[model samples]
Target: MLVKAFDKNIRQNKTTTINTNFVVIGGGTAGVCAAITAARQGTKTVLIQDRPVLGGNASSEVRLWILGATSHMGNNNRWSREGGVMDEILVENLYRNKEGNAVIFDTVLLEKVLEEENITLLLNTSVYDVKKSSDTKIESVQAFNSQNSTEYVIKSPIFCDASGDGIVAFKAGASFRMGAETKEEFGEQFAPDKSYGELLGHSMYFYSKNTNKPVKYVAPKYALKDITAIPRYKAIGKGDKGCRFWWFEYGGRHDTIHETEEIKYELWKVIYGVWDYIKNSGEFEDVDNMTLEWVGTVPGKRESRRFEGLYMMTQQDIIEQRQFDDAIAFGGWAIDLHPADGVYSELSGCTQWHSKGIYDIPYRSFVSKDIDNLFLAGRIISATHVAFGSTRVMATTGFCAQAVGMAASICVDKNLKPADLLEKGEIKNLQNELNKLGQSIPNVPINKSSNLINEATINASSILNLNQIPYNGDWFSLSISAAQMLPFKANQNYKFKVLVKAEETTTLQVDLRTSIKSKNYAPEVILETQNFNLEKGEQYIEISFSNPVPNNQYGFVTFLSNKHASLKTSNNRYTGVLSVFNGVNKAVSNNGKQTPPDNIGVDTFEFWTPHRRPDGQNIAMDISPAIEAFNADNIGNGFVRPYGTTNAWVANLNDKNPSLKIEWDSEKELSEIKLFLDPDYDHPLESTLMGHPEEVAPFCVRNYTITDLQGTILAKKEGNYQTINTWKFDSKIKTKGIIIEAEHPSVNVPASIFEIICS
Candidate 1:
């Protein structure tokens, strides 16, 4: 090829236009979820991202751990991990990358997007302009990919704005708020003031590794010269890396969007300065062999330009745990806020205020108030600043974005706007659709319309009868108070017996506790207390309680802490039983109890959380008149997760072959069968840094087979490790009855199923 002389007129880059049913801007967690969900729901979708990678803050570039409800098991929100597509991705990541490598996580997100045939993903593409069909509707958007030197104009009927900076919404003239709102605006007593901070800031992280040999480093000219300028400089240690220094931040005082570059420079200076002190300051040892392995180029952004929607979620809604008729999603993270000065400020890095329990998110919060075709997601959803502090986490953002995705699909099918779904009879349809997709909405049961199982009689080979947890020779000291959470029926008198040992003669106190609300897990109401005098040697002691059980719910059989006593624990873990301790998880709670300032619109309570796997063994105990919650009838209850009671059908532990049989009055054609299994929702599937202990949920059924009344095998599944498993037959089968034979994943745990549906 020969080069010619440059002409006066310039040549334009290649341009392309694509038309689709839906468009999601910003390929962060929210955008990834929205685009994937819409595509799965039979909609043609396009996902656009300005960066080369997907996950916004959770990507390898930023490397912040993704979390939502079940916040590090720090609070009382048990079995609260998000469900549906977000759950699928988290579970899959845990199965593949339990080590939590950030680069490996990037591949997981890419694979999920690529697997969806209906989705089109564009990376390193930035949307610079927006085109509107009318004053109130966006028609298309203009974007350019720097890597390819290409311009793209994408047109869609519905659009979702999940960009961290609200780029598309801002260009489309959507109303938004940048800083914290005044207390009077939303009656938010916990709202931050001018001195406290108006917005949460940006943060960058660096990872360090040991070379095992001597290494040297020299600071560049731009590196910070003074480490003493940072008030918390002494808090930095030699071995600290990544989010261990999440407080190492800046850029809250300036414009977070336009001044991002300036903010990034400040963060880099702080990081390099911190590293320089760790290396050559001679204040620490063992760091001579350590070097910086990776540094974040893009800072993880917390908040900016929250766009307005139909309804603005406020602090009162979260604190009160208010129920909404249009509820579509849920959130449980604490209301966490940081200082404007970031790491340089003398104040603590964050202030987290947790509610008593999880709260519902309404569908209105995802819909635009002015723009007819616009949908808002992620940190841009409508909410007051105080409420945004809790809802801004990645998992919460991703779950709410799922609602937006499904709403977009419905809008395309019915030719209706987002507001149309909020009408009296239409909201339930949306909820029903979400339930069908495996989303566990708080207080929302699965809708059963055309399900064939609803008209059949269900029977199991053996239902779990609560009796005893055999001792495994493992003993735990009673240095802290421990409680066993078990399902108790209404108007029942229960007796519990446990093996106890005392170094000296001690008086052990046992109390029966329950939550004031039936659905909540917090044990605030003490029903009864009993004191038993124990001898110096190990012996079995029994306690009886006849307190009034208001309704069927999980009650806490608590054994108060005794310094001179110890109790036996069992390795026989059940599907719905858990043991908790009144202890502190310094990440979320400073002390074992939460005591807030008076009238701050937050609650004060004790945190009773379970220990992680290989440690959280069940209390060995025997009960008379065992719990009857796990029956075959529970399979048709329409609930797939534990609420006030265990909504699962668990077989007896000793049953070698557990099976379920469903019989109808007459033969009916069935095309598909779906089974919802147990996934141990108590485990918080953090994307990175916090690695999980198990690849597959220990309570899941590994193998199962379905057969008709004539004993002909219809479908079989092996090595199953997911929450939902579906069997679609090539042709409709006419059968009067069907039987499901399943095997437990482990001998310690029994086979359990939450729901079964056939159509």
Candidate 2:
């Protein structure tokens, strides 16, 4: 090392310039996804992250779990996990870090980005200035890294601003909103008033550990001494840690970006003050052995500047479940909001209201209205404050950002700007490309013209009849009304036989119900009711509705609550099949129902949600006429996931060697084949703190082989746990037909495939 003397008290740092096709700012969930997805789509991408690690709020520094449509399984959106790159990250995290260690999750994201050869990751770099080629286009960005004392100039044709605070968009002079809109502005009844607060706050979390031996703790001088100042300090608990303290928030009233450091200090005071109370106050016990293991140095920010785009999504778009022609992504999380006062407020921590189904997110919401080359993503995307409550979740933001990545690739290819893709055909092309990558838009199916499998005849060795779920000696009491949501065929008669046990003679009422809307999972419409008188002992009981299903949709076979009755449950769980209860998740419901204020632009409905694994077992029952939705012909239906119907082809549980064959009239050359498998989309894969029970989804195919006409294996994979599998041959494989053989991930669960494409 050499020391240099400064002349005239002037010094300079090394500077570098990099050229890329696309640039993604802030390596949070959205930016990481945008960069990875664009790189995978053949665009050279540069990812700039100010933090040392990727995964902004979800990183080990913040440790907030990644949750989206499957809102901790607290809502009725079934099979609603965000797909594409986000799904891959979550699935990989579940497989490797089911314990939900935040450090491991960080590694998962880093590995994903590193694996993509087209992505160049720059960590510990912050953008301080932006260069504009024109009033409407961004030419480059200037970033600096203090770690290496270097300045960087990155140039790109397209730029995506996924930074939570909207740094690039703000510096680029993009129009944006920082607070709530008036009720008259968008006819939004749920808009927060000035007194109630206009913005959600920032939060920090701490973790505690038990030391078998006693440990002492001392409060710092800066720690707050008064804990009772918080309105809900009694809600704190000994077992609570990390995200449980999501209410320990502040700084929403101040400018979130400029005053971030100040807000972090306030959060720190609250966190340490709360800990001091827990240790010193007489209210808690066994505290001598407890010690703080980790404390968040940086607070997780919730909201800031929402940039303007062609379309500003409002509360109506979410509540109405509106479909957009240029839809490229979907979100199902409830419209959740919090008061500006945060933990010190007298109001509850949050107010959440859910929609009946998932809603579409338009491409227009991501493209900047003023800047032609800028793509908005994450919580900074174009949306009213009322709508941001639902769209701000990490997974949902990442899903929308994936669409921006695909759009960026197309823009680079066509030498066009982001807004140029708004043309009908261009948007459709973007949608089709996203679907091919396993991202399913609401009510949108893959185009048939793009897949060669649609032109051939398909058959499977055996299709699952789904006649019965064998009992596993597990009995669950009917503490509340329970129902099995079954995908039933149109105009089909149904009868069920279930094993029941009663401590005393009880009257059991069985009702068949369906949703008023075909795509909804809520059981609101009662088709028929049947009453049965049961004896005191365990026995088999049969209930017949007599009425056939009116349409091809999911029907609920309900068993009303009886204090002395219990029903048998089975371990066999299948895709598009779940048992729900008429109960409250408390997180999204108020006493088993959503009773919003009249004319508040929200609905009143009961929540029917499924239980997590090792608990919400399927009801053991036998049906007279088997459900006919699981047929071999479904492989070519173009739908990759469950919609109004189960679009998957499921194999018989008894069939050991399940195989699907695609045949053509003459030999055809194919170089690539793709298969879409079921990964139990209903399960919420929270990235950190929320531990899962399984290493791989039970519905995933564990082993599979692809063979040609000569019975020679072209591709073979074992221990598979992903949703999308692709096979590319070094040379063309010419054959009249191709066969795919797969083994079920679980013995009780059958092997299933959503769609197969060959080209």
Estimate every model's Cα lDDT from 0 to 1.
Answer: 0.89, 0.90
As a TM-score, model 1 comes out at: 0.98
For residues 245-351, what per-residue lDDT tens digits would candidate 1 score against the true structure? 88988988889998999999999999998899999999988899999999999999998899999999999898899999999999999998899999889898888
- lDDT tens string, model 2, 360-470? 899999999999899999999999999999999999999889999999999999998898887536998999999998899877788998888888889899998888988
Query: What ranges in model 1 sit over 4 Å off?
Result: 1-5
List candidate 2 segments past 4 Å from native: 1-3
Query: What is the C-alpha local distance difference test score of candidate 2?
Result: 0.90
